[model samples]
Target chain A: AQTVTQSQPEMSVQEAETVTLSCTYDTSESDYYLFWYKQPPSRQMILVIRQEAYKQQNATENRFSVNFQKAAKSFSLKISDSQLGDAAMYFCAYRSGIGGSNFGNEKLTFGTGTRLTIIP
Target chain B: EPEVTQTPSHQVTQMGQEVILRCVPISNHLYFYWYRQILGQKVEFLVSFYNNEISEKSEIFDDQFSVERPDGSNFTLKIRSTKLEDSAMYFCASKGGAGRNQPQHFGDGTRLSIL
Candidate 1:
């Protein structure tokens, strides 16, 4: 079984500033994927970015990036030049990479979530 | 960009009644999945469908729950007997490409309210 933990229940950042949301996971599998999702007021879950365990290089998508420390089981999300639109509920999720089973494919274990507030 | 779409947007049902949530995955997608999130809880996987059959399901997907791809485009999840605890936001997702590396795209989700 795998579990994702988002220690920060809430985070706030001033407009145009930067913010980091922390996440950790416990997984015995060596190969897996980590993801960050954003749920705006519309409640639609949107993929922010993803990182593969095998890749030592952190993933970056525009303003969203991740600090992935595989040895520490930590994958934190960083939002640079944060905007008001970044205000939303953020979730950290883990998915196994073992093939031939749905457990490794479609199923994802998600953290409770971190509410991000962007202050003007 | 292609995206998954769900129907009804919201559903209200009485306890013990039947409720069906529908989704239309991306046209080229080879995998389908169902997940639910209680108001204040983490999202949980319910089931995954491929090749016209269920590939895997979670413990939460008991006998009372069923999934179907009745047509070329429609994927549906039916709860035989709705309970108050079944009230949540049900999301439908689709994954393309090969293996488990592909990122799954999620729909807007249907809010199921069981009274």
Candidate 2:
């Protein structure tokens, strides 16, 4: 079975500063995908960024990026120049690659989530 | 951009009552999924549907829970008899491709509250 862990339960960042949310996972499979999702006060789950285990380079989407260390089994999300809108609960999720039947390779195992607060 | 949409942002019902949560997946999406999160808990996958049939489901999806795609675009999840433990935020998601690389788009989710 695969599992995701978010060590930080709560985090706060000043407006226009940067923040990094930590995540780790345990999986025996070699091929997989990692993702970071954001849930705002409105409770909408939004995709922040994604990283493939095979990719050595980290994934970056505008202000959101991921520091994926496959060997360490860690995938952290970094929000640069954070804004008030970034205040939300962030979750780290893991998915198996294609052709894996453990959970249909479609089901996502999510972390406990880190609640981020943006201070003005 | 196309996205998944769920109806009834919030629902309140008495225990043992039957409730249906609705979702309209993206037009081109072939896969649909339902997930739930209890307050302060991690999101858990409930069921996954493709080609009008359930492809996979979690242990949480017991006999009391069912999913259907009655129409081309509408996907629905029904709870036969809701319990207090069933109160949680239910999220609907859809993905366009068959491969696992594609990201699933999620709706705002319906907060199901059992009284």
Question: Model 1, A21-52: lDDT tens per residue?
Answer: 99999999999999999999888889999998
Stretches > 4 Å off in candidate 2: A101-105
Q: Fraction of reference contacts reproduced per prediction?
A: 0.64, 0.62
- The TM-score, computed over Cα atoms with residue i paired to residue i, of candidate 2 is 0.97
Q: Which pairs, if any, clash in model 2?
A: none
What TM-score does each of the candidates earn?
Answer: 0.97, 0.97
How close is each model in CA RMSD to the real structure?
Answer: 1.2, 1.4
Give the candidate number with the greatest DockQ. Answer: 1
Mark the 10 consecutive residues where model 1 chain A has the least summed lDDT. A98-107
Task: Please provide, for model 2 over B31-101, each residue's C-alpha lDDT reduced to its tens digit, 9 standing for 90 to 100.
Answer: 88999999989999999988778888999999999999997989999999999999999999988876657
lDDT values, one for every candidate:
0.92, 0.92
lDDT of 1 by residue, B15-82 (tens): 99999999999999888999999998999999988888898889999999999999879999999999
Measured with DockQ on alpha carbons, how good is candidate 2? Answer: 0.60
Model 1 has an lDDT value of: 0.92
